[model samples]
Target: MVLPGVYAPQEDTALLAGALSDESLPPGAAVLDVGTGSGALALAAAARGALVTAVDMSWRAVWGARLNAARSGLRVRVRHGNLFTPVHGETFDLVLANPPYVPAPLGGRRPRGAARAWDAGHDGRMVLDRICREAPALLRPGGVLLLVHSALSDPGLTVGCLREAGLKAAVIRRRRIAFGPVVRGRERWLRQRGLLAPADNEEELVVVRAELPV
Candidate 1:
């Protein structure tokens, strides 16, 4: 159930949601979902009895998630703003994110409409990098962060970023998925930049779990 201009639940969302379901959530665990487009991951956490707060930069997404959560009776608090900004100074027991991570050409204006949901800067680490850098601050000790993105954006780089920020991080899930429309449209540019090769129509996706020391 996704609204227009909002990112829909897809393979990556399913992978992350499945991971969330397997976790042993503490009593009333506080969960924050950054870049919560359709609130899919956030809803998963809420289902596990987590007190979920979801934030997104797009107002449409914020409302869509709020409405969806309400209909599901999930009690998610949805906010509209850039990642981490809307919930300033609030720490959580868990942080979850599915940020934009598709590498695209540089030198364009900010992505519009649904494109803003996935068009990351060249190398595809723009939003993911920011999440890695800033999310740790919103986590209490013993807190964990679950993040998902395409391997085309470099999962190892994400691990490195999280570890550098003082978290123990590792890849918890990896899957190969065929390129979606966005990637297919930008294949020529990706190949030109050596990020993709001829005949490459698929990419690997990864979920990294980063946790602070107990």
Candidate 2:
């Protein structure tokens, strides 16, 4: 069960989960899950025999994830901190992230609670951009990073960022989904920003995978 202020597993979460399942994870692989809400992805990785670390900025998420892991009898390292900060200097075999990518007017103030889980500034790249820039450093040779975000945030930009960082990056999956409350509420603002069309109510979620050279 998701605790208050914790992001529940939704379509994008399921998409990432499915992709994680399809991956050929080496036994006891070192796995990192950034912005791991509710510990779903991290637990899934643990269930596959991977050594998992899940990070989030919310204390609630940290506690919730730890509780969930303990209840499931899975070992997971859950830390509360901004994305990647708590795990600085660590390299992993695979990194997974499903960060906030909803476009909204954030007013230059850091959001709180549920809004903090989804709002990503006017262009929705606030967090996604940072993830793309920093995640590669946390990967070992031949390690892979899987990131899922709204297509409206421009998934290609992410692939480009990873590629620029010397990794092989590409969009591995895309799914069209109806706008969630966060997106729907900002429809007018998004349209004004030219990110959404007058008749558009759906947004595409894209999963970009980047692999470091072995």
**Candidate 2, residue 127: how far the Cα is off, in Å:** 1.0
Relative to the unseen true structure, what is the C-alpha lDDT of residue 214 in candidate 2, on a scale of 0 to 100?
A: 90
- Number of the predicted model whose lDDT against the real structure is largest: 2
Q: Model 1: per-residue lDDT, tens digit, 129-161?
A: 889989899999999999999988989999999
lDDT of 2 by residue, 1-214 (tens): 6899899999999999988998999779999998898999999999999999999988888999999999999999999899999998889999999998887787788777888888888788999889878888899999999999998898888999999999999999889998888777878888898898887868999889899999
Query: TM-score of every model?
Result: 0.96, 0.97
- Which 10 residues in a row give candidate 1 its minimum summed lDDT? 104-113
Go through the candidates in order and give the clash count of each: 0, 0
Candidate 1: residue pairs that collide: none
Alpha carbon lDDT at 32, candidate 2: 96
